[model samples]
Each structure stands twice: as C-alpha cells, then as structure tokens.
Target: MDQTTLNYIVVGLSFALYFGIAIWARAGSTGEFYAAGRGVHPVLNGMATGADWMSAASFISMAGLIAFTGYDNSTFLMGWTGGYVLLAMLLAPYLRKFGKYTVPEFIGDRFYSTAARVVAVICLIVISVTYVIGQMTGVGVTFARFLEVDVTTGLLIGSAVVFVYAVLGGMKGITYTQVAQYCVLITAYTIPAIFISIALTGNAIPPLGLFGDHTESGLPLLTKLDQVVTDLGFASYTGHHSNTFNMFLFTMSLMIGTAGLPHVIIRFFTVPKVADARWSAGWALVFIALLYLTAPAVGAMARLNIMDTIQTGEVGSPEGNLLYAERPQWIKNWEETGLLSFEDKNGDGRIQFYNDKNADFASKAEEFGWAGNELTVNRDILVLANPEIAQLPGWVIALVAAGGLAAALSTAAGLLLAISSAISHDLVKSVFNPEISEKGELMTARIAMTGAILLATYLGLNPPGFAAQTVALAFGLAAASIFPALMMGIFSKRINSKGAIAGMLVGLVLTVGYVFTYLGMFFIPGTNILPNTPDNWLFGISPASFGTVGAVFNFLAAYVVSMQTEEPPQEIQDLVESVRVPRGAGGATGH
Candidate 1:
C-alpha cells in the first residue's frame, strides 16, 4: 500500500482504539468523572500519568529544540524530568492524601476560603489553556501533513475527536485511553530511534549510540555532529551558548511547573490510596525515562542526517549543496505541508542550509556564491519527518504519525479535564451554585471541556511560538502562580486564605505582565510592548525564565500578607499536619 493509505489506516486504528476505550470506561458519577472513582492500580496509573505527562512538548518539539540548539536546550530534558521528580517526591502523595477531587478544592479547603479556591481555578484555567494550545499546535501540524488538510481544518478535526472521547470519558475514560496511547507512542518513538541509531552508529541502543562512534566518520557521534554544524557556521552541537543564570531560572521554572500542573497533579488523585500515588509516580518516571533517554540521540542523529543530505561534499565546495530539483522525497512531502521550504535566494538552483546571520559566515558564503540560507525548516517537524528522512518503511512512517497524534491527544484530554473540573466543580458548583446536582455538574464538566477545547483550538491557530516554546511559557505561568500556593498550602500552616490569594495574584500578574510585554498581550501578535530579545529582558532574564523570579515574589508576598493577618485556624493547621502523615500506608500493601 502507498504511504498515504498506510498513514490513514494506522491513524484510523489508533483513533478507533481511543474511542473504544472511552466508550467502555465512560464515567458514571462525579467521582468517576473527576478522579476515576479512585480505583486505578498504581502501575496502571503510572502508565497513564506517563502518557499524560509526555505531551507534544515532550514527544514532538523537545528533540527538535535539542537538534537545532544542541546542549543549550538541555534545560528541557533536565527541567521536565526533574520537575516530575519534584512532583512525585514533594507534591503527589501529600495532595492525594488531602483527598480532594481537584487542586483548587485542596487549596480552598486548606486556606479555608472560597476566594482561594476561585483564584486557584483561574490559575488552573490559564495554565491548562496555555498548555493545551501547544498540544493543539502539534495536532494541527500532524494532521495537516498526514491527512493532507490545511492546518485550520486539521485542528477542527482533531478537536472534534478529542471532544468525543474527552467529553464522554472524563477522567475515567481519559486515564484508560492514555494507557493505550502510552503503548502506541512509546513504540512509535523508540522504533525509529533504534532504526536510526543502528543505521548511523551501528548500535542498537539509541542513548548509548549517541556517545558511540559514528560508523560513517569513525568519530564519536557528538564529535561528528559538532564538526558538521560548525562547518556550516552554526554553534557546536554540544556547546553551551545561553546565559547561565537564565538557564538556571528556566530549568527551575519547569521543575516547579511540573509539580504545579493541575492535570499531572490530578493524575495522582486517581489511585485508591495515598501510597499508591507515590508508587504511580515511580512507575511514571520509569515510563518517561524510556522516551527522555532516547530524545537526545534522536535529535543528534536527525541533525547529522540533515547536514549530510544538504552538504553531500565538502562544506564550501561548489558541488556541496543539494540541488533543489533533486531534493529528497521527505523534503517534498514536508514542503507540501508548508512547514518546510526552500527559496533560491542567490538564483542558485542548489539549496543552502547555513546560518546567514553570522557575519563571518556571510564572507565565506559569498565566496561560494550563496546569497543566504535557502532552507527554512520548522523545528517541530524534525521528529515527525525523521523516519521519512532516513528512508524508513511506509509502516514506520505511519506509526510515527499515530504516535504524534497520541502524544498530543492524550495530554490535551488530561488538560481539558483539569479545565473542565475547575469550572464545573470548583467555580460553578463550589462558588456560584452550591446546590448543583451531581448530574448537573457532570454535564457542566463536559460543557466546560468543549469550551476549553474550542478556545485552545482558536489560539493554536496563531501560536506565539513553537510548540515547545509555547509549552515553556505555560510552565513558567504555573511555576509562578500555582506552585507557590500548593507548596505553601501543604508545608506552612501560618499562610492564611488572604495570603494564598495575595501570592497567586502577585505571581500571576507579574509573570503575565512580563510575558505580555514581550510575547504580546494574551500572545496576540503586534501587541507586544517591547521586542522579545535579550537586550530588552529584565536583568538578563527571558520571559520563559521569569517564572522563578515570580515565584520568589509570590513567596515574599504571601509571607508578608500572612504576617500582617491572623494565622490559619487550629483545625486547618491540624489538617495540614495530618496530610503530611501517611495514613493509608499499611493498607496500600493489601491492595
């Protein structure tokens, strides 16, 4: 069968499986819809969490960032992985023990104020909606290429599929469906890595292959990559080029953001016991490691392949560049999607893929009669196109298409559920309509999810940045606003409702104001107050790294507000103390 037909069949089968799971595990009650009735096995919950945690940022854009920027982007790997550790170690078990359906519920009860809960709901909505935009972008990119549709139509189709399953299954449906998605995505991710690893380094393990010698050049894989990129006037593949302080802040933001993310924290609420939450976190780390370890190798190998294809001979030679007419099939397929393009800037028929912004490189390029960089490849397309660029089988390419969609859809479902629960359970039911029936809340949850998906889809069409960069902004927002509130709610009994609310407002306003000044208000283009450059950043801190600074302000504001007000009531303090203790530890073994 043709590759296009294979893609349709594979993606169709995956969608059918998701729909089947959603139908079978459809939620029946508010408890089931919000927390899967708290019956998920630790191992199973772990697998589901893995799927939920590894969104389009992890699967699609992460390696692409690593491929283009090399070691400077390692913050993505460290921050995300380390952030899960922070979640598992610091937040999951305690939050699960608090026995709340949602993060806002925990915050409201702990702070003893509806206002705290409402603020949390707002934070959840903002963080989740921002996060969902990245997933929708990934979905649109995948569908546009594989389904041969425009990005807008592809996003609508993907949105409809998500609405059917996510709105139907809620947490129960999403949890089980995510397990199946984990299987599909991991298989899709690793198979290509293994294939490319063996092809390039003659090694079967991709992570090890990254450090192993390249079979073609007899040099270490990273060493050869450094050589190839430097020859094209790009930074060395393994060099660190970003500001150290900014990298520290960015990584810390991701770590705290991971712990604060409502969708991920709510996954812990699905397991039956508090101990099960910790166990699930452990299992999730194992599953997540499978992909995280493979990502660097995939990035390096894909970069090497692109360089080799473009510079078939010596870098500066007249015959080095690939002819536009004879470009590879993978390039042609991607070009059709409009994500990858080549322009003959110097009227040369050959494609030049070099850094034209480097003044030193411009002199060398002029010697070769090259006008400017001719190829424009979107960073998000590297992984999806990797198998094709390597000439993998039709089935492998189709599988990757399925995997990308699975990664995007799984996390989108989780985020939408978080948003849905916050609106129906936290806002409408808790604050506005306390007498809301269970059935009414469930319907509201579904409706909220539909609205959230629509908003996400609309914003995704005009994303402010690449998928991973967009995700990073979401992380920064969560880090600044939610992380401080959750951490203080659990660890400090002196923090009152007023303090919690004050902290969230301070963090949210500061981070959002900083980001809007550069990225545009609500990320609408042409609305930015300043150019988003290092020179324009405050104290050399980029918008993506400003979350840590915001968190510090949150901490200080909460502390100051609490000192001026009364401490939390005695019972609320005791409740905080009780959650810290492991009440159901012994019972977890019996299960």
Candidate 2:
C-alpha cells in the first residue's frame, strides 16, 4: 500500500479506538468527568499520567533534539523524567490526599482565601494553554505530513476530535484516551528504535546497543558518531559542545518545571488512596522510562545515520557531499511539507549538509567545489521520519503518524480539561453558584469546556512566542506560581493571605521577567536586560533552570511574610491537618 493510504487506515483505526474508549468509559457525573470519579486504580492512573505527561514534544521533538545536539541536550531527558521522581517523592501523594478536583480548589481552601485560588486559576490556565498550543502544533505537523492536509485544516480536525471526547466525557474521557495514546506512542517510538539497534549493534536493547560495539564499524556507536561528525567539521556528537553550566541549569529547570505542572498533579487526585498515588507515580515513571531510556540511543543512532548520509560519497558529486538527486525517499516526503528544504546554495546539483558555523571548514568546502550547507532538517521531524529512515514497512510509518497524533491530542485534551475545570469548577461553580444544583453545575462545566477549547484553538493557531516553548516557561509558570502556592497551602499552616499573595506575585514576576527578557520573545529586540548565559545569570543559574530558584524564593518569601503577619484560621488549620493525613475521602475535593 502507498504511504498515504496506509496513513489513512492507521489513523482511522486510532480514531475509532479513542472514540470507542470514550463511549465505553463515558463519564455521567461531574465527579466522573473531572476526576474519573476518584475510583481509578493506581496502575491505570499511572498509565494515564504517562500519556498526559508525554506530549508531542516528548514523543516527537526530544530525541531529535538530543540526536543533533548530542549529550549537551541530555538536560531535556533528565529534566522531564527527573522531575517525576521529585513529584512522586515530594508532592503527588500529599496532594492526592488533599483530594482536590482542580489545583486552584486546593489553594483556595488551604490558604483560607479565594484570591489564592484565583491566582492559581490564572497560573494553571497560562501553563495548560501554552502547553496545549505546543501539542496542537505537533498534531498539525503530524497531520500535514502524514494525513496530507493543510495545517490549518489539520488543527481544526484535531480540535474537533478532542472537543467531542473531552467535552463529553471530561477527565474520564481524557484518562482512558491517554492510556490508548501511551500504548500507541510508546510502540511507535520503540519499534523503529529496536529495529535500528538490531541492524547496527547486534543487540536488541537500544540503550545497551548505544554503548555496545557497532557491528559494521567495530566501534561503540557513540564513539563512531563522535568521530564521523567531527570529520565533517561538526562538533563531536558524544562530546560536550554546548556550555556545560547552561546545560546543567537547563536540565534542572526542566525537572523543576515538570514537578510544578498542574495537569500532571491533577492526575494523582484521581487515585484511590495515598499509597495508590505513591505507587501510581512509580508506575508512571516506569512507563516514562521506557521512552526516556531509549531516547539517547535514538539520538545517537539518528545522528550517526544523518552524518553517514551527508559525508563522503553517499549522494553528492564524486567530490561533493550528498547530491540533491540522492536525497532519501523520506527526505523527499518531508520536503513536500517544506520542513526539509534544500536550496543547493552553491549551484552545484549536490547538497552540502554541514555545520555552517564551522569557520575552519569554510576554505576546505570551497576547495571541494561544495557550495554551502543545503539540507535543513526540522527537529520535530526526527521521530516522525525515523521509521522511514530505517526502511520500516509502510504500516510502521503510518502507525508513527497515528502515534504522534495520539500523543499530541491526548495531552492537549488533558490540558484542556484542566483549563475548563479551573474556570468552571473553581470560578463559576465554587464562587458564583455555591448553592447551584449538581446537574446545573455540570452543565456549566461542559459550557466552560467548550468555550475554553475555542479560545485555545484560536490562540494555538497564532500562539505567542513566549507561550509556545515547552518545558521551560510552561513548567516555569507552574513552578513559580501554582506549585509554590500549593506547597504553602499544604506544608505551612502560618502562610496567611498577605504572605501567599506576595510570594506568588514575587515568584511569578521574577520567573516571567527572566524568561521574557532573556528569551527575547516578549518584545522585539529585547533589552538584553539580563544575559541568558550561565556566567551572567543570577547565582550562575541558566535562565532555563531559573524556575527552581524562583520557587525557592516563593517558599522563603511566604515563610518570612507569614511569620511577620497572621496565621491561617482555626478551621482552615484543621482542614490542613485533615488534608495532611490520608484518612477518609475517596472523592476528589471541590466547591
């Protein structure tokens, strides 16, 4: 079968599977819709959290990032997974014990202030919406490439599908959809990796193969990649190329960001008990590790493949780097979407793929009759194009597209659910309709969800630059704002309204200002007010890693201010003690 036909069949099967699951696990009440009725098994919740946590970025973009950038990009790998360890150890079980339907609800009751919850609601919306846009963009990219549709159309289709399940079934719908998504995305990720590892190393496991001898070359795969890339004037793939300090900070930032994210936290709220939350986190990490462990291998192998394609006699003229005519079928397919572009800058029919910034290679390339670097590969295409790169079957390629969409759409739906519930459950129902009927409030929640989706869809289509990047700001906002508030609410009984508000505002401002000014996204030609470089950063922290620092500031500020002011009220203090212990409450807390 042709790739496009296979794509349709695979995508069709996935759609049917998700829609069917939505039907089978359709939520009837607001409780079921928002928190899966707080009756979910820890194992099942872990799987759902895995899917919810690994969005398009993790499935599609991350390995490619590590593939091209080498070990310096390992921060992404460590940041994302390491944070889960922190979440499991520090936050998940305690919060699950707190039993909130939404994060803001916990903040509201814990701090004995509506303002605290409102601030949390804003931060949650910011984090989830930004996160959702990236997922939406990933879905569109996958659709445009595999499903053969314009991205605008793809986004619309993606949105419509998510709307149906998410709006209808709520958290119940998203949780089950995520389970299927995790399976599809993980299978798609690992199968090609296993094939590539077997082909190259005679070892079945990619991670082991990564360190094992390459069968053809008789060298460790990393060593081979490092040698070959450096021979072509590119930095050694296995060596440290990026600034070590910045990379360390960036990795730490990702970890803290991961722990701070609200949507991931809410997943724990659905578990049956405190112990279930603890075990659930362990299971989620286990599932996540399946990909996290394999990602480095994929990176190394893909880098090796790319270098081998570009160097010494693959495609270009007898003297030139790979010729334009010799482009792979996968490259041709990706080129159709304008993601992989080749301009033949030298007017030679051959395409030069190299590190243009390598000053030492300039004179050598000129002598070799090469023009300039011609091949441009988008990082997001790495995973999507991996099956094709490995000469996998048409079904495998098609399956990858479905898997990418599933990962993107499922996470997007989870974020949307969180956003909608924050607005409806926290704001509308909690504050406005303290006396409203359960059915009436559920109706309001559905309406809120629909409106939230529409808004997100529009924002996603033209997202702000600051808003779109994953791991850093999205997680930063959560950490600097929501995570801090939730922590204060739970651990610090003395955190009064004044302290909570000031701490959140301070954390939010410092983190946002640093990200915006240094990232140069908030304004055109930003002030260079603060250098993003590690040496120049506050306390030698990478701007990417600054959220953890900001979170610490929040903790300190709240603690100091609380000591200087009043304590949490007697009733709220009792509520804190009740939440601290894992006594009763099989249900998630709410208005």
Candidate 3:
C-alpha cells in the first residue's frame, strides 16, 4: 500500500482505539470523572502518567531542539527529566496523601482561603491553556502532513477527536486511553530510533549507539556529528554554547514546573493510596526514561542524516550540494505541508543547507557561489520525517504518524481535564454554587473541557513559538505561580492565606509580564514591547528561564508577607503535618 494510505489506516486505528477506551471507561460520577474513582493500579497509573507527561514537547520537539542547537538544548532533556524526579520525589505522595481531586482544591483547603483556591484555578487555567497550545500545534503539524490537510483543518479535526474522548471519559476515560497511547507512542518512537541507530552506528541500542563509533566514518557518533555540522559552520553537536546561569535557571524552572503542573500532579490522585502514588511515580520514571534516553540519539542521528542528504559530498564543494530537482521524496512530501521548503536563492538549481548567518562562512560561500541558506526545515518535522529520511518501510513511517498524534492527544486530554476540573470543581462548584449537584458538576466539567479545547485550538493556529518552546513557557509559568505555593503550603506552617495569595499574584504577574513583553501581549502578534533576542533579555535570562526567578520571588514574597501577618490556623498546621506524615494512611476523600 502507498505510504499515505498506510498513514491513514494506522492513525485511524489509533483513534478508534482511544475512542473505544473512552466509551468503555465512561465516567459515571463526579468522583470517577475527576479522579477515576481512585482505583487505578500503581503500575497502570504510571504508564498512563508517562503518556500524559511526555507530551508533544518530549516526543516531537525536544529531539528536534537538540538536533538543531546541539548541546545548548540539552537543558530540555535535563530539565524535563529532572523535573519529573522532583515531582515524583517531593510532591506526588504528599499531594496524594492530602486526598484532593485537584491541585486548586488542595491549595484552597490547605491555605484555608476561598481566594487562594480561585487564584490557583486561574493559574491552572493559564498554565494548562498555554501548554495545550503546544499539543494542538503538534496535532496540527502531524495531521497537515499525514492527512494532507491544512493546519487549521487539522487542528479542528484533532480537537474534535480530543473532545469526544476527553469530555466523555473525563479523567477516568483519559487514564485508560492514555495507557493505550503510551504503548503506541513508545513503540513508534523507539522502533525508528533502533532502526536508525543500527543503520548509522551498527548498534541495536540507540543510547549506546549514540556513543558508539559511526558505521560510515569509524568515529564516535557524536564526534562524527560535530565534524559534519562544524564543516557547515554550525556549532559542534556536543559543545555547550549557552550562558551557564541561564541553563541552570532553565533546568530549575522545568523541575519545579513538573512538580507544579496540574495535569501531572492530578495523575497521582488517580491511584488508590499514598503508597500507590509513590509506586506510580517510580514506574512513570521508567516509562519516561525509555523515550528520554532515546531522544539524544535520535536527534544526533537525524541531524547527521539531514547534513548527509544536503551535503552529498565534501562541504564547500560546488558539486556537493544535492540538486533541487533530485531531492528525495521525503522532502517533497514535507513540502506539501509547508513545513519544509527549498528556495534557490542563488538560482543555482541546488539546495544549500548551512549556517548562512555565520559571518566567517560568508567569504567561503561567495567562493562557492552560494547566495544563502536555501532549505527551510521546521525542527518539529525532524522526528516525524526521520524514518522517511532514512528510507524506512511504509509501515514504520505510518506508525510514527500514529505515535505523534498519540503523544499530542494524550497530553491534550490530560491538560483539558485539568482546565475543566479547575473551572467546574474549583470555580463553579466550590465558589459560585456551593450546592451543585453531582450530575450538574459532571456536565459542567465536560462543557468546560469543550471550551478549553476550542480556546487551545484557536491559539494553536498562531503559536508564539515551536511546540517545545511554547511548552517551556508554560512550564515557566507553572514554576513561578504554582510550585512555590504548593511547596510552602506543604512545608511551612506559617504561610497564611494572604501570603499564598500575595506570592501567587506576584509570581504570575511578573512572569507573565516578562513573557508578554517579549513574546507579545497574550502572545498576539505585533504586541511585544521588545524584540525577543538574547541581547534584550533581562540579566541574560531567556523568557524560558525566568520561571526560576519568578519562583524565587514567589518564595520571598510569601515568606515576607506571612511573617508580617498572622500564621495559618492551628488546624491548618495540623493538616500540613498530616499530609507530610504517613500515620493516617487512608483512602483519598472527595471534596
């Protein structure tokens, strides 16, 4: 069968499976809808968490970032992985022990303030909505290429699919659906990595192959990659070229953000017991490691393959460039999606893929009669196109299409759940209508999810950055606003309602203000106060790294405000102590 047909069948079947799971596991009550009735097995919850946690950012964009920027982008890997560890170790069990349906519920009860809960809901909505934009972008990218549709249509289709399963199943349906998605995405990701690894390094394990000698050059894989990219005036694959302070801050932001993310933290609420939550976190790490470990290898190998394709011979040789007329079928297929294109800047009828911005390469490019960089390849396409670039079988390519969709859809469902629950459970039921019926609450949750998906789809069409960068911004927001509040609520007895509210507002406003100043107000085009360049950043901190700084301000503001005011009530202090200790190991209670 043709590749396009195969892609349709594979992606269609995956959608069928997700819809089937949602139907089978349809939530029957508010408890089931919000927390899956707290019955998920630890291992199963871990698998589901893995699918939820490894969104388009991890599956579709991290490696692409690594491939293009080299080691400077490794912060994505370190930050995300380390952040999961921080979440699992420091937050999951305690939050689960507290026995809340949502993060806002926990914050509200812990702080003994309705205002605190409302603020948390706002933060959750903002963080989740921003994060969902990235997932929707991935969805649009995958569908545009595989389904041969425009990005807007693709996003609408993907949104429809998510709406059916997520709104119907709620967390109950999404948890089980995510487990199936985890299977599909992991298989799709690793199979291509293993194939490419063996092809390039003659090793079966991708991570091992990354350090092994390249089959073609007999040099270490990274060493060969460095030589190839440097020959084209790009930075070395293994070199660190970013500011150390920024890298540290970025990593810390991701770590705290992981712990703070409402979708991920809520996953712990699905398991039956505190012990189960811990086990779920551990198992999740294992499942996440499978993909994280393979990502660097995939990035390095994909980069080398791209360079090899463009520079078919020695770099700087006029005859070395690949002829545009003879470009591979993969390039043509991607071009149809508008994510990859070639322009003959020099009218040389050949493609030039190099660092044209490198001034040192200018004279040499003039010597070679090259005008400028002629290939425009979006980083998000690298993984989806990797198998095709390597001439893998039609089925493998189709599987990758399915995997990318699964990764995006799974996380989208999770985030939508967080958004909906924050609205229905935290906002309407808790604040507006204190006596909302269970059925009314469930319907409200589904409606909230639908609205959230619509908003996400609309914003995704005009994303401020690539999938991963947008996600990184979401992480920074969460880190600044949510993580500090949760940490202090659990660890400190003196933090009062006023303190929590003050800290969250400060963190949220500062981070959002800084991000908007550069990324555009509300991420709308032409609204930015300054250019989003390195030189324009504050204290050399990129917007993506400013979350840690925001988090620090959150901590300071809370501490200062709390000491100047009254301490939390005695019962609130006891609640904090109980949440931290394991004496009363009981089942989670619903609000």
Q: Please, what is the whole-model Cα lDDT of each candidate in the order they appear?
A: 0.93, 0.80, 0.93
1-591, model 3: which lDDT tens digit per residue? Answer: 888789999999999999999999999999999999999999999999999999998899999999999898988988888988888888998998888899999999999999999999999999999999999999999999988899999999899999989999999999999999999999999999999999999999999999999998899989999999988878788998889999999999998998899999999999988888889999999999999999999999999999999999977787899999999999999999999989899998999999999999888888888899999999999999999999999999999999999999999999999999999999999999989999999999999998998899989898877899999999999999999999998889899999999999999999999999988987876899999888999999998999999999999999999999988889999989888876745454221
Off by over 4 Å in 1: 583-591
Q: Which parts of model 2 have CA positions greater than 4 angstroms off?
A: 312-320, 463-469, 520-543, 581-591
Kindly give the number of clashing pairs for every candidate.
0, 4, 1
Clashing pairs in 1: none
lDDT of 1 by residue, 388-496 (tens): 9999998999999999999999999999999999999999999999999999999999999989988989988987778999999999999999999999999998999
Clashing pairs in 2: 99-589, 315-323, 316-322, 316-323
Instruction: Return the TM-score for each candidate structure.
Output: 0.99, 0.93, 0.99
Order of the predicted models by lDDT, top scorer first: 1, 3, 2
Native-to-model Cα distance after best TM-score fit, residue 28 in candidate 2, in Å: 1.6
Candidate 1: deviation at residue 355, Å?
0.6
Candidate 3: C-alpha lDDT:
0.93
Candidate RMSDs in Å, in order, are 1.2, 3.0, 1.6
Write down the TM-score for model 1: 0.99
Error of 1 at 339 (Å): 0.4
